[model samples]
Target chain A: MKNAKPSSRRNFLLTAGLGTAGVAAAVATATRGEKPRAAMPGATEGSGYRLSEHVQKYYKTTKV
Target chain B: MARMKFICDAERCIECNGCVTACKSEHEVPWGVNRRRLVTVNDGVPGERSISVSCMHCSDAPCMAVCPVDCFYKTDEGIVLHDKDLCIGCGYCFYACPFGAPQFPQAGAFGLRGKMDKCTYCSGGPEENHSAEEFRKYGRNRLAEGKLPACAEMCSTKALLAGDAEVITKIYKTRVVTRGKGEEIWGWSMAYGGSDKLSDLPGGKA
Candidate 1:
């Protein structure tokens, strides 16, 4: 019936809205549980401490 | 590579507060913040000792460990620095620090505390090296300028030595050997993870 088609369309929309919300909630939860990475300059991985050439030379000068 | 470190010779320190003044001037630190200070033990006593105190840039910093936002990071030279942008001014780092290094600006109204500030070991923050933004947030980047910390450099008695850990250790050992006493280095063991007594160092007992 024509009335049944309208009800089915509403049901489809409701299902799609719920699905979208479920995905959003899932993503939010994942983001909350994730550990935030440190904002380090010139570091790609790990805790940003690196012994570059300049530091190495400075060390040589500090030697007794 | 060498890990940055500081060694304050209590025997030589005159409690002049020169290190504190130098640090404040070099950084233009605000009124309420003292990045470096002199701690005197046994005040008014026969043999009181004064030691320059600041952020030790610990091998394993407690502030970094307890930061809820994970804003603290260590540089290649082992300087512990924090990002002011990420800091919440929660005073958690203040409680976690053993040296009392974390300082919050108290100029806000309604008892509001500002972002935590502390000694950066003459090394700037995550901003560009020597940039105005970096100086505004973290003070001078003397380390990046191929120089040592101002506090140590300005010590009149050369009581405060700052540089690579291995080198300073050697320098301290020589001093202990020459003086023939005062082997204890306050906060060295706690900060650097070793025996605080310089007698433990090689040639320190001589």
Candidate 2:
């Protein structure tokens, strides 16, 4: 009975290890195929601040 | 970090329509669909002024807000883009745009509306950058190529400036100060006069 428990535990560990390897391979393949966004010249040269509503309000104030 | 922007000095614009032509030619924009154009306030008048108009890429874009399909997305550079594949040709964006930037091309035997088209700030759409799919739907992705919008770069008078906002604003401010800003704008009154008093305009605590 003790030997049976040990074998089942080993089997569980083996299944878990294989499942993890399969997930890692899938992630690597997906990442390789996906094209990530590249930085633009403007973004590289200057502060790439998001143009939010507060900025628009500030721009309205500066309109001469 | 360049905050991409475009500013056209009315005093320098001669109504040449050069900017319009540049944008059209660069993108191969279809017939009857203009992504950029010159708006002259008082043509023929001595002190008349003109400004090139297009999508300003507003911080709070109404088109983005109103798109029922939720196709619009803003890039890190503040360029507004949309996925043509997701667009349903419902024309909600056309009505929502304050600049009249959204355009529709007539299609099919029934004359149905094609997908929505707009300036894109020359940054193209959500498609892979500079891909044929992007070009066929949204025209060129010049910004990704490290180039300014064709309209501003090709302006003959140097009136239309496009770059990081701070740089262009500085250039515009210097010109205005050095040249002695004019006291009277010929068509400003005609084009923008509704009421002199604030109370006359439609305003109340809804």
* Candidates 1 onward: DockQ, in order: 0.03, 0.04
Chain A superposition TM-score per model:
0.56, 0.54
For lDDT, the strongest prediction is 1
Question: Taking the tens digit of each residue's C-alpha lDDT, what string does model 1 give over B71-127?
Answer: 999877788999999998888888999999999988576757789999998877898
DockQ of candidate 1 relative to the true structure: 0.03
Poorest 10 consecutive residues of model 2 chain B by lDDT?
B197-206
Instruction: Report, for every candidate in turn, its global Cα lDDT versus the true structure.
Output: 0.79, 0.71
Query: Residue A26 CA error for candidate 2 (Å)?
Result: 33
Q: In candidate 1, how many Å is residue B10 off?
A: 0.5
lDDT per residue (tens digit) for residues B1-206 in model 2: 55677788887787889889988887788998888888888788888889999988877899999999999998777778889899998888888888888888765566478888888887778777755666778887766655667787677777887766765665555554446443134552342333223233233111
Which parts of model 1 are misplaced by more than 4 Å?
A: A1-64, B107-111, B182-206
Which candidate number maximizes TM-score?
1
Native contact fraction, candidates in order: 0.04, 0.06
